[model samples]
Target: MRRYLPSLSALHAFEAAARYMNFTRAADDLGLTQSGISRQIRNLEEFLGATLFHRSGPRLVLTETGANYYRNLALTLDRLEEISIDAVRGRSVDSSLMIGTHPTLASRWLPERLGAFIGSYPDIPLEVMPAMPSTDFETTQLDVAILRGVGTWLHARSIELFPEVLAVVASPALIPPGSKLDPLQFAEFPLLQNAGRPSLWLNWLRLAKLSYSGRIQGTRFAHHEMIINAAIHGLGLAVVPTFYIRQEVANGQLHMPFGEPVQSDDSYYLVYPERKFHNPNVIVFRDWLLRSLRKA
Candidate 1:
């Protein structure tokens, strides 16, 4: 038994005619003569065994059945178009965004807030990759990157998230029993450092208008979080971004000695290639990030 189906061309003819409700306009759209469009529409109505259009008077109007069929057929055509585009592109019809972020944001900032994005875009799959913010976008699959910087990324568009504040923190055991800490005493304890940010302590001191003549050095680490951990274990006093250790400060895992937080010249930024300015995935993530971070 042959399933009921008409020539795709005939269905397209009827759809176009139903769209304009005028055979002449539909014929012009499909690059066919009005007679050809009328013939195709007739073939379609004959196959369906239904009068799709009322032939009363010269004005053509879709019948009740034809109007209902047109609604469902329009949806089917849209789905078919999406499937065709996705098949050619080899990607999900529902967009998927790959984000690159540094360890601090990826571990501390993003984890708590990403669920909102997931909830909003349940249809869009999102993947967060721990990567340097300045990683090459041309060579990577990452659609967007969130990283800390002074906001001058050439060839990339950026939106400022928040300013960074560095503070001197230490384990409780490292501080001696005293009310006022002699600024010079800072040199006595091993200064925890991250090789990636060797100037953090120097710049922080400069901002505080304090100077240490002694060698400001200690166990160097590649990652910022590791420096925080070293300071927590009493290995040394560490200078870190105040934002990363909010819970630690509240829970007494780390203590900030008497001093104001040092504000860096840089801030965290959400960035992507300028070429991706209008990419759907990047646009949604960018808007979501700005709203989420700015609100908090």
Candidate 2:
């Protein structure tokens, strides 16, 4: 057995230098002077009884042994880092309840409803993760996700929260005086599109049994908030989700021209891994969420 277990500092220095292939750059990355990095690498090389670097005029090249050792050491260190992160996050993963949601839902809906949940379960700490629609829930530490889509997630139990309804809306200033425009007249205005749901305007039009070619041409935004802003700025008419824009409408920032909303196939859903259903926190959150939705 080789009696050399290299110092962790030296090993770290060697790994940094090996990755950059330049001592000065490695030193900058490690927040150490170039000389300090060089000494650490030398110490590591001596301990291993092998030459790790071939020093030229201003460049350091890895020897064959150095290359092989670095490959193994880099993999080992990466695994160790992953393990450490997993260990730390494991405590939260097991005890802390994480809820992932879309930005609009988190900002407009969840905050108002979470008070009751927090009050009911005083012992459980809730962590809200506002994530993108493309976030992978399995790899993430999130225990549950509230997503806006048709309930079709794989390997998870999903409960429908509510049906999403959308309508053509704009600021009061945008509605022209003496303009008694019906749903069909919506084609005349500059339409705004939600980039995430590009077909929203079309779907609403289809539901209304009206066909207009101009629905495809419009300003597009990735978030519901941006669409709301555009409508509020009198930029154009937007087909916005009713739940998200309720406050804006109530506050007179936005106006709904139509009497009825266009119902969408899309719905809000609460999803959790099947195995996590037994968790006490998950059970409490699911029950609270269902109750709140019912009350709403």
lDDT of every model, 2 decimals = 0.81, 0.81
Clashes of each: 0, 0
Off by over 4 Å in 2: 1-91, 132-137, 176-179
The estimated TM-scores of all candidates read 0.66, 0.68
Which TM-score value belongs to model 1? 0.66
**Which lDDT tens digits does candidate 1 get at residues 39-113?**
998998898989899876899999998988886776577567768867998976548787888877788878888
lDDT (10s digit) by residue, model 2, range 1-296: 87658888999999899888998989999999999998999899888899999988778899999999987787678557757766877743356688999887888889998888889888887789876545444344467899988887765778998988888897778885345677777767788888887888788888777867752678889888888889999988998889998888888888877547888888888988675779888888999889888887
